[model samples]
Target: MLKHTGRRQQILVALVAFLVSALATVLASTVTTASPSVQPGSDGKSGSPGATSTKPSAPSSLSDPRKPLPIGLAYGDTLTWKNDQELAVGLGDAVDSGAKWIRVDLSWNDIQPDSPKTYEWQRFDRVLNGARARGLEVLATIGYTPKWARKAGCSTDDACPPADPAKFAAFARDAAKRYASQGVHMWEVWNEPNIPFWAPKPDPAGYTELLTATSKALRQADPQAYVLMGGLAAVGTDPSIAYVSQGDFLTAVCKLGGNKVVDAISYHPYTYPYLPSAKTSFGTAMEDISSAQGNLVSILAGNGTPDLPIWITETGAPTNGPGTATDGKTIPPDTTHVTEAYQAAIATDTVQAAAANPHVGAVFWFSDQDTGQAADKQHRSMFYGLRHFDGTPKPALAALKAAILAYEHSR
Candidate 1:
């Protein structure tokens, strides 16, 4: 995802420049991948023990609520980070192009690097404020265990509670309390907790416990704020692997009394090379997620939480593969590398899918711009953003604008 050269860098400079802006919690114990044997809470409600349901005002129309924009978040720990200014511009672009919401990750580890007393709100203030200023709601992800809160042998991004469960819970409570004040309401407890991305060995039971605890903290902080279950990564391709299949993870959670714990289910359906439909081959990038979604819904229904919605909180298709083409051209997909058309079509499709799916409440495209994380930064790779590596918009940019116009007109 690295930028090619000076010309490329300048082309994407606007996105990077605006980013000079903006900027989670937890608990712990012996984290094992064990499963609870009892049936899940199917009492038609969700809350910590002895807590009662306090439903928020329902949507104007449940029939076909305008889905949230399938967009991206400005993630941290990367070289090409996004600042508040860049985020504002990116969100403005998305809003102008018909996006209803924007996803922003509020890393628990980074925010509470030490203790709840050492909370950091400056970074997030910029991002949340910027997006809101442009009329975009936030789908905030609140997770990432800091080194201090993790257990022993937790070497990588994935691992258990940094130190203890109480500390994690404190962090979670503080996050809910603070964000609630900021008006950046929707909250996702963690990111793919069922996978190694959060925990090395798919610890479904342990994650359920984490979700339950975090959900309690959030509900206490702000009854009005929406709390979504973390999206599970697609793990259906192999049963024997250590990863937890998103479907199976849901099933396990349902069994562990997790049905009434959160408001909705979130997911990361990273279908690469974009399949035209979910019925594509198993190997097809997003096909597995499409398939997993089917199974997950069934699991939810069986647990009697069928009314809960699904949010493709994160989803996108890379536009940079050699075999890739938008409407059928072999050109590159970024501003510098290719025309704006490819990027626009990809953005349009992301919007189209989000709008079409009735079950999906939101769809935040994976990013605002590429941060040059690795090699092979395709014209439309993750490193490939709406604008070129420099500050120019590719075909995708303009295409997205047209699609947004059509979307608004449809209303």
Candidate 2:
């Protein structure tokens, strides 16, 4: 998922220029696949020892009677690599756009590169502190195995799960204790574990173990913290590869008792090319997340927890990027790439659809801004941001803001 380019250097120059202009005016701000798994391992029956049996339950609404449904933005690794000033601007834009929450990765490998004994908090400190300064809540996604903690023979890949779940739990516990008071209360256990890229091979029992350990540790450190299962990548079944469908993965995890430890199930239902409401030809109606939500609910209920909520942690359509259009048009000339107008329309529709669903608690757009220069980046996925990489607003940004405001007002 890492791309090398001079884009960061370019962004740095743009930020510097913007900062100078703001100083003149006294300030300113700016902003996985799976296969028909050999099924997720179920330890025989539900509620069995080490298996989750507690019925899934939603957080009590009375707990925060006045809190509004959250609209968040996935800020990616920006905080981990960007400077303080860059972060401040990005966060400020999020606040301005009515984003109630911002998700950032808290990579274990980055924080404890050498050994568990040596922890580096400088980068995360700046991100948490910067977000707090902007009056924004943070959803810290904790994951990635350090080289020392990875299983034997595994490359130094962050996606590899640690050989010892307790070590991962210990890191999570430390993070929870360190950031509980910093206005970072929500924690997502990992990122797209359903995909092979995120996990060497998708294993229900293994992910469940990681989730259980991390959840328990975080709870012990901060009882009030909300722990969410990492968002599953939305894709259909394909037997040839080692990927599992989101539905099957959810079923296996629940059967293995994942529901007992998690507060909510998270997913990234990116329906690119097709609108969120469009039905996919792939037998399953997952292209429309609302349909997927129904499937998720049924799966959870059957596994024992029927009352859990779904958090759409990431989803978006890129307006312009390196990709062919569904209509078979080449993207760059404005003939093939998804039009800005279409992106805005779909964004608005997607948010509205999520808001209408009672099961959905939060909807976080894939990003607040696009990555790299739109013209130079080879990966179209990097263009999913609501704003262009250089900080210019896209129509989707306005659409998102409006959707958030409308949803809040209606509530």
Candidate 3:
């Protein structure tokens, strides 16, 4: 998931960078391993409690009026910003791309940058309302501690955990309460907490505490919401650099009862240099999601949350780099970089693979459109859109749309 080396530079501009997204709310005090229960409000008309084993089949027409999509068919996009017009155009484009869901940041710093009591709801509200108007479901990733929320003289990246997690829980409750009625039920705690995104260092226990508090606070505000643990970035253990393998980080959290408190596990299983279908010796990417015996599914099962659902909150491949081959598109490379053709292949493989696996509740491609001529430091490449920066649609987007339509209707 660490596709860009300049991520630190990117973080300077993204006050609400990737939220580790540990989330929760009206979840039953004790969750069942196989299918977690959601409140009636969360399910909308379905009014079902637990997640359905088989997702509702997709409508015949991709562009037809999209009913609330089933989780299994929950194809989505991770968006960086939600300006007024972009929602209508960008999100509208998402729908055209066969995406029914959007995972967007609800930065705590942006909302309450002034003080604990001060709040600004106008901009965030536009996202919720806009998505609702377009019938696109939203998963709000809430995190990013404000300057005041961090300890004094704390000069770490915005990934710093709040000095008072309780304060963040309050902000989460307020945000959840304010948007629940406006049609936002999915909440992710933070983004990639298992990496440098957690700041000073990645602390599963600290993140667990924050998720627990935020989950409890959300329960009070909106009993109908479904909370997800922050999306764990796929990485190996490297204490020398303050990194913990996703397996170790999650195992530690599950030991602390993190698995028992939430409805589903959020993960970012980004398979780039290799396509999702590639058989690699290295145990990373899609293998972390399902292929390997030690993937998220088995990990949660062994740790006590057996058959728990996994929402692939972020996954995609970069379209350009030194790795690019002639003919303008490269195949998978030896490094984590891949060409547009291969990236398009990933877009197809990811959707088809998720459809074949029931444990995957959702898969949101890392972007909706491109931001740079090619992914680089300035654009925060990780969240680049599926299209070219020039506004020309990439093969990845079309591939994703066709794959979704095929998977959904076939079901």
Candidate 4:
């Protein structure tokens, strides 16, 4: 969620350590940033560079893989500028890969850049059109305040919260009305409100205030639609960072009755190096989202929102980053580096873990394709994609498809 802002300084510092490894040699000899086995298409077709053309085979009719537990994906901003053909291939891949849902941004800043009276829906309309044609469900994330709406004296960043909650609610109501015909009902309020994405500083009470108004507006626009609080981050406490941890932030929100405002809870459990299915007493976020005593699971139950569902809106690991001479086998504190095989295992295990947990409703991988080689905030984020930047499918893609199929058939 804070992808554009390199504000996770503590996490970024640990991510910088990701580099080439004498240790990675033990994991797999041919493993590197560029996987040798990466091919052009998921369906055996050849696509030229930049993923311009690689027709994924039509999704199999054998059985609906999305029946029991489905996987969803966010393509980052790759589809924002792609042509219709390229957009079809990306969405097509999601269908062929067993994804039932597709997450999209309905940014307030983008749709209403000037006066609040004027609105633009064409850009998002194009994406939603493609998603519906592919039979994919939409989770529209609503946030990124326009400059006019930002509180006075705040930095000129889009992450700033609006000066008034009612104004923000009006925007949400309009977005929901405009898209109700297109079958977009699920809404995720803001992205990463527990961090700098909320701007200046994160405030649980303030976010609860915003959610109360926004959720009401969404349901009013379409009575059937559900609202999800923005996906809280998945990292533990670090003395270096000024942001509140997801656990503490959720506690404050629940204390203020936030759980009663939103229809469900959204969380991002981005576990790398270690898998989400692991059971241990370690301080990883898996405990915070799942088994730990004071975790969010218990938080909701104690707060009187016992039946509320948990949506894993985002989670995934990167296969490679800036290669370092340090031993990658030992694993650094915040690095996202893992081999392609390991990443594939993450795809499979993430589904398995969610399927085993009754509280988790859906799982969407953070990205659909690798973005680029350049690092953001010293973290090589490009490699998190299940496919290469050139539109070639990675091993993780097939792993995700198989996991979804397994889950469906078992049910």
- TM-score per candidate: 0.74, 0.79, 0.78, 0.79
> Taking the tens digit of each residue's C-alpha lDDT, what string does model 3 give over 76-144?
323335456655766766677788877888888778877887887876777667767877778888988
User: Among these predicted structures, which one has the highest lDDT?
Assistant: 4
TM-score-wise, the better of 1 and 4 is: 4
Clash list (residue pairs), candidate 4: 19-323, 19-324, 20-323, 20-324, 51-390
- Please provide, for model 4 over 310-368, each residue's C-alpha lDDT reduced to its tens digit, 9 standing for 90 to 100: 77888888776533212224566656477778788888988888777767767888778
> Which runs of model 3 end up more than 4 angstroms from their true locations?
1-83, 325-336, 374-383
TM-score of 3: 0.78
Stretches of candidate 1 off by over 4 Å are 1-88, 155-160, 237-241, 276-278, 281-294, 321-343, 373-375, 378-381
Q: How does residue 278 of candidate 1 score in lDDT? A: 35
Order of the predicted models by lDDT, top scorer first: 4, 2, 3, 1
Off by over 4 Å in 4: 1-67, 76-78, 238-240, 322-334, 374-378
Candidate 2 lDDT over residue span 1-411, tens digit each: 134457777788999999888776652222112222120112233322232222212232222334466778887677688776777768876887788788899999889999878988997998888887777778889999889999887766879989999999999999989987775668899888878756567888899998988887886777566778898888765656767878888888887788777767888887656666655455223333345454887777777766566788888776664453543122234332466777887678777877666667677887877777856555666777778888888888888888788877887
Worst 10 residues of 3 by lDDT: 56-65
RMSD to truth, every model: 21.2, 21.7, 19.3, 23.3
